[model samples]
Target: MSASERYTFREVTPADLPLLAEWQLRPHVRKWWDTAEPFTAQKLKDTRVKRWIVETTQRPFAYLQDYSVHGWEDHHFFSLPKGSRGIDQYIGEADMTGKGHGPAFIAQHLKALFEAGVPVVATDPHPDNTRAISAYKKAGFEVFGSSQATQWGLILPMKVSSSS
Candidate 1:
């Protein structure tokens, strides 16, 4: 079946912390996500980020987050227009990688953010993560430049603006 037909999104809750931590330990996920340190439930709870679990018809298979750029302190994104949101996501299952799911779900989430009145959305992937950069590009994001303010160190800053 098609990716859109097989997958959906659900709000992440504290109950899902164990699953998230497990996913963070996956080699594929850790390579780009940099989960060297243990991922704790408390850390998830303390962050202002909003998260979602991407599920297939039968089970959760990915993690996604959306956060306000302006709400963060000492970052370069303040120059973006107000109401800009930023996104980070990954398909947790190794089998789920390389499918069209990444771009499809990213587009789905971007539409939701835009419809919710966010003027723009951005993503910063480590410069060498070609897979993520390609997916973001397919999801309608353009590489505007690079940034050093993020934990990822050097990142390729990408963005999409609401047409409305």
Candidate 2:
């Protein structure tokens, strides 16, 4: 579908944990993950994974994965300076791919984050994923530069500078 079509954002919840876990196990999610391997059985057992469900459920948007902690590094890419929400997102559903929802979805949240006092927001996709790169650009993120790959991390910094 084109970006003109409508979509809704649902924050994650405890009730959604099983589904989230299932999604985590998908090859698509695993492909771009920061982890070198698929999430381990013990890793899945960890209580912290549940937090992605809780925090996003409370927030104004859906989470592709957690960004408030653990994921983003302390650098220009993940850093929000003073007035930013430091948000991240993903389109977890396989059916949602190549449909133009990602740019619109991200554009919505990026605007929201800016309104919430964010001065900048950044996301990094795999270097080889041109589709995601295009979607990020369509959402108004501009590439900054490249960095060394970390685990499943690839791609470069694509950032939006807020007007606040």
Which candidate tops TM-score?
A: 1
Q: After superposition, how far is residue 69 of candidate 1 from its true place, in Å?
A: 0.4
Instruction: Give the alpha-carbon lDDT of every model.
Output: 0.83, 0.57
Q: Which residue pairs show backbone clashes in model 2?
A: 83-117, 83-118, 84-118, 127-155
Model 1 global lDDT (CA atoms, 0 to 1): 0.83
Each model's TM-score?
A: 0.88, 0.67
- What does each candidate score in C-alpha RMSD? 2.4, 6.0
Off by over 4 Å in 1: 1-6, 37-39, 147-151
Across residues 31-99, which tens digit of lDDT does each residue of candidate 2 receive?
665434434445545542322321222333224432432334644444446543334455556766677
lDDT tens string, model 1, 25-135? 899998888676655666667555788899877689999988878876755566889989889999999999998889988998888788899999989898888999999
Candidate 2, TM-score vs. the true structure? 0.67
Q: Which residue pairs in model 1 clash with each other?
A: none
